[model samples]
Target: MHLTRTWTPPGAYDLPGSLAVLARGPYDPTFQVHAGSVWRTTRLRSGPATLRLTPAASRVRAEAWGAGAQEVLDGLPALLGEGDAPEEFVPRHRVVAESHRRHPGLRLTRTGRVLESLVPAILEQKITSIEAYRSWRHLVRKFGEPAPGPHPSLHVVPEPRTWVRIPSWEWHRANVDSKRSDAIVRAAGRSSRMEEAAAMALPAALARLQAIPGVGPWTAAEALQRSNGDPDAVTVGDLHLPRTVGYALTGERNTDDAGMLALLEPYRGQRHRAARLLTLTGLHPPRRRPRRQPGDITRL
Candidate 1:
């Protein structure tokens, strides 16, 4: 459906800003799009939208198209950023400020809740990205809703109830093992609690997620990275992050998680921000390993 909405000034500022940071697609699946399963593309759509401020004559207009547009746009500030942090949240302040300085048009977003972010993060565990994304596309398209507006081709994430009911055969088809699938099911069982965490303080939110089965430090951190924009919430058990960060910062080409943490010590609460910098600086260390191509699971 074609709809229209208006944002006076500050209210809508967070919406468009979020789209920029979360739209990197394949480069950052944790934030960009919500996955239903292993083989679908879901995007957030917006109604007729515009932004204007009282002090200036210039106006900015926006239009988000596709499925999940409302969910994403409505939930951006909640998932990708925070509006209530104190000025003394020094790490966040510095990170946001630095981000502003370096990327003037940058828009931080909140990715909604732990459930949506965590499911994919878990799927990504102990596997290559191609594996993770394939699993996501498969699961989502099989279970998710059609896009809400004019863009029926898009899909919204499956509801928690829907996630809890997925069949074992389907999971196997997507290359999802019982461990990750169980974790997703458990999280979905308490989906309401996860949604409640969005209104909580960062630490409290992290604690809530940890209480769920199979969601530990790494998964929580990954979820919070998008849902809360918490600069200090570093992924403790990521398979590839430590080496990537280490090589980018020290040129040593390898390091453990502890070493990566130590190297990022100066950034403290802004570890994610430091990582984002290393990512955008375009300084990837030369690859020493063979590249893996994606397997076509659909024909299996």
Candidate 2:
């Protein structure tokens, strides 16, 4: 009922960084991070599955359990960024170059599951990550199934049908606003098409996703970054990214989405990769004061 596989990074790979991208938030329900291992429970096409990744001297050892164990094993390489070519990047900024040099092993992961990403991405729209994560955690704990085998403590994300069926009251109780909750329900209803869309070319895939009412450029970009390890999928409409990118690239504290795109034009085919490398450096735009917190819609 369990399977184990091994993968060695092509040259150098940051196992933690690759996995970190999949963790929706620090309090994410589905992805669990431990001292030296990463645990993830997913509802695969085959069935629910759990994966534990442990780093070794030169490679990672992956153990999976459940009906979808083989699927998880097959996708392990892509998830760990086996297909990503980080060495080929040529950064235009000195700080970015330093980050790439420091973490030559950085790689982008591809999950190949759109609905899974879509649900959380919807919950995350226009809200602080903490708020979104809290809602996600509440929903998953209430609906997700227990992880198979000895990993009894972990939980897999609920199936698409379950997502569609979650009552409006439950969503409100989870502190999810009407707009996001409705979008998730609609997306869950069309989860199959979204999964099929993942096999298409990036442009087509995004278009198919955006066909849904609530999916937009930002949500599509975020999903594609995980679903396909899209190198060029730069996230727009982010509250802080433009400033962060602009400040790091040009030392300008004020910038917008258009400005961020303009500044990243030099690395057109690898904008997301560039942005991620910049973030790894822990550089941020200078802040004058703390930003306002997200409103508690559940209270209203």
Candidate 3:
């Protein structure tokens, strides 16, 4: 069975940017950019669906196949950021404002799949994105089901119960240390509540997710950005974001998380949007020295 949907963008729509936000890496098994279209899979309350989204002038064309086709169709608009109002944000920095003016098409998307975002966020705790993405690709390729329809290369993310069942040895094999793997399992144990929290108020949802021992502000914010499109969701505790945001705003490379928050306070409800704009502007604190990128332990 197939389901089709179309969405006209409220402004300039960069389909790749809209979809790239969902993909963890170029090697991510669950999401991929291919042939000028986005191919992805997710498990809905009904079942798993694989979708192909093709970009058109001022419109997005989507087709879904599988048991969850109808649900994916229903969620397509929100996934395309139909619920987001980028205009609501008032940038506090000259760089941010200029980038916002230049990139009117950049919008925060809300997929409302809490577990889908949460699990990967867990894998990312204290690890470099490359390590996290590789871990995600390995685990999903091993445990996830083949996406339905003709796109067998795609994989539907496993249910929370499956995540919980992955053994400690298996996590080690995937190069995911005990801490991050355990966090994912613990969060998966209450998958129903987590998914429900996605629909709750943003603060309430973050609080609910943070109830898990390993889930923290940073992980919760990352999950909310993807699942709820929380514009104010500022990622805390990142190794580079504080410096990046700070340098873009204050020309200071010595800034920390507190400094980043202080600088972002002027934007208050629109901090994430402001930071995103600054990031798009290609402004950065000059590199004094190359920081060591995280190496994959699983290959060692």
Candidate 4:
């Protein structure tokens, strides 16, 4: 079944910038950018679907195919960030204010599919993005079915049961360590409860996610930011975000998570949005050490 919709946002909307966070990497099998439209494949509760979004003047054109096509179209508004209230976010810092002014079209996207975000967030735990992206691409392409759309290369993300059934060796082949793989399997086992978190309050949703072993504040926050379009789901434990937010706000190169939170205290209900704007400023403290290279676990 093919479905289509045209959505006009209440305010400015950045199609590429808003959806950029959902793409794991350039080679992600479930996401793509071709011919001025963004293509994404996902497994909905009803079934798998492929969605293509094209931005036109003052509106976005959305098209979908497969059993979940109607469901995808129904949620198009929320998926494109119609639920986010960016105007209420008052940027306290100059850097944040400038970024907000510069990127008026930027809005947080809410896919409302917890497992879609949770699995990827779990894979990214304590690993280089290169490693995480590589593993996700390998696993999905190897296990997932072809997307039901014109884009032949695009593939839908695997269902929770499929994720749970991936053997140990395949994960190792994808360079995924036992810990992350185990977490994915556990999360998949509880996929129903996890998906329910999408409709819960942010704090409750976060707690629900963290109830799974190996999932923590960072992972929970990362998942909800996309799944719920939570403006205040501040990622508390990241390798570089604290430094980036701190330096951007206070010119402090040594600020930790606590200090970063303090700096963002003014934007209590929109801390994540504030941090996002800060990062968009392209300000980062000078690196004091060599960049961490992606690890090769397949050799292990």
The estimated TM-scores of all candidates read 0.73, 0.97, 0.96, 0.99
lDDT value for candidate 2? 0.86
lDDT of 1 by residue, 1-300 (tens): 222323333422333344444332453322232221111223323322111111122223323434344553454334324442323233323433454355443334465555677788778777777788778876776787554433334555677888999998888898888888999999989988887876677789889999987888888887777666676777778766787778766777677899989978877866776665555555556777788766544465
Decide which is better by TM-score, 1 or 2.
Answer: 2
Off by over 4 Å in 2: none
* Candidate 2's TM-score: 0.97
Candidate 4 colliding pairs: none
Could you tell me the lDDT of residue 154 within candidate 1? 50
Quality of model 4 by C-alpha lDDT: 0.93
lDDT of 3 by residue, 1-300 (tens): 888888898878877776677999888889988888899899999999998999877789999999999999999988988888887888766888889888888888889899999999999888778888989998998999999887758899988899999988888889998888888999999998899987887789989999998999999998998999878888888888889888887788878999999999998887887777877878778878877687766665
Worst 10 residues of 1 by lDDT: 48-57
lDDT of each: 0.59, 0.86, 0.87, 0.93
Clashes per prediction? Answer: 27, 0, 0, 0
Clash pairs, model 2 backbone: none
| Candidate 3 worst ten-residue window by lDDT | 291-300
Clashing pairs in 3: none
